[model samples]
Target: MAGPRAFAAAASLSMLFALSPATAQTPPTESIQIGLSTDAISITAGFSGADLTIFGSLENPDPLIARQGRYDVVVVLEGPPRPVVVRRKDRVLGVWINLDSEAFENVPVSYSVATTRPLQDIAEPAKYKQLSLGAQNLYMKPVDETDSPATIEEFTAALRERKTATGLYSENVGGVQFLSQNLFRATVRLAPNVPVGTHKARAFLFKSGMFVKESSAQLEIRKSGFEQSIFRVAHDYSFLYGVFAVSLAMLTGWLGRLIFRKD
Candidate 1:
C-alpha cells in the first residue's frame, strides 16, 4: 500500500511540472492592427491640405521590448493607381517643347508616409525597396521596357520630383507616436488635390530592426457639395455637359460684347 501511494504522488508531481512550462510560455509572435475613425472622407472645394490621423494597436507585444523602445511603426497612405505620362520639355528656338516622354502603368496618384523615426534609422534601404515603400524607393515600371535604363531612371526621378513639388508625395519623420505600450497614433498629410478614389492605409511593425508584421485598412476619398455634382454630371452625361458648356461660353461672350461695345 505504501509503495502504490508513493508512485501515484510522483506521477501527479511530474504531470504538474510538464503543464507549468506550457502555461508559462507566451508566443513570441507579435502583430499590428490599425483602425480609421471613418471609412470615407469628403473634400470640399477650395480646401487646402490637411492632416489625417490614424490610430493603431500592437497585439501580443512583449512588454520588455515595448518598454525599451525597440519597437517601431511606419504608416503609409497610398492613393489609387492610374496610368501616368511624364513629359520632358526642352528649349526649342527659345520656346520650350515637349522633347521626350515616358509612360508608366499603375502609378500611385499619391503616397504619404509617417514613421516613428527617419526611414534609414528604421530599417535597411533594401528592406524598403523590397517592400516598395517610400517615394524614393518606390518602383515605377516603365511602359516601354526596352527603353534605355538611363532614360527610364531620369524620367522616374522627374516624376517623383514633380509629385513632391505638388505635395502628393511626402514623408514625415517622427510622425508616429506610441500612446501606450500597445497603442500608437500616426498623422499623414493629405494634399489639397488628393485624388478621389479608394485609398489604402498600411502599418508596418518592426522589432529590433526586424520586420514583424503588417496590417491595413481602406478609406474612400471623394468630393462633396456643388463640385461633386458637377463632377458626376460631367462623367455621367458627357455629351450634354459639353453642349451646355459651349452654349454657356457663347452666351457669356455675346453678353460681354453687348455690355461693353465701343460706340
Candidate 2:
C-alpha cells in the first residue's frame, strides 16, 4: 500500500536518475511495457475470479518535458463476449409479468477500467472513443434486425447498469497509481462470473491530454482440475454427458431407497 507521499518521493528520485549525465544524450522515446501478474486463470467448482495486478514502466523520454506536465495512465480490461437478454417486468392485474424485452449479441461479459484520473480529464470523448479508453466507447449491438437506435441505446444502458451492479463492468478513476515516476501499478478484480476465454487488456499513456503510447496483452481464464475435465466432456460429448448424468442420478436414488427402506 504505497501512499501518495511515498510515490512522490519515488518519482522525485526517479527523475534525478533520468537527468544524470551518464546517459543523457539518448534520443527521445515515448513507450511503455505492460504485463499481467499471471498468464492463465484456472477455476473449479467454487471458482471465483481473482485479483490481477497490472504493472508497467513508462520511458522518461525527456525528463525536462515530463517534469513540465505529468503523464496519465489508463488501462482497460475486457473479456469474451456472450449474448445477453434484458427484460422489463410490470405488475399486471394479479401478478408481475415480463413486458418489453431486448436482446443483445456479442456483449462483453466483463469490462473494467482503471485510470490515474477521470477519463474525461485525460481525453475528450472523440479522442477517447478513437482509442477505446473507457467503457462508454464499447459498441454493444442489438441482436434484433430492425431495432430503433434509441431503443438500442436504452438496452445498452440497461446492460451496463446490470453489469455494473454485478461488478462485471466498472470504472475506477484514480485507481492507477504511480509507484515511481516511470513505474505504475493497477489492481483489477475480475468478477466471479467472468466469461471463460481469452480477454484483452490494454494500456494507454496520455500526455498533454492526448493519446500516445499504447500496448495490448491477452489473458486466458479457464476451468481447471475436475471442473476443467467436466467442462471439456460436457461440451465435446453432450449426449454422452447427459446419459451419464441420468444414470448417476438413478444410481443415487436407488442407493438412497435401499438404505432407507425396511419392512
Off by over 4 Å in 1: 1-26, 249-263
60-164: candidate 1 lDDT, tens digit per residue? 777788999999999999999999999999999999999999999999999999999999998999998998988899999999999999999999999999999
**Which residue pairs clash within candidate 2?**
none
TM-score of 1: 0.85
Residue 155 lDDT in model 2? 75
Q: What local lDDT does model 1 show for residue 28? A: 54
Worst 10 residues of 2 by lDDT: 3-12
TM-score of candidate 2 versus the correct structure, residues matched by position = 0.80
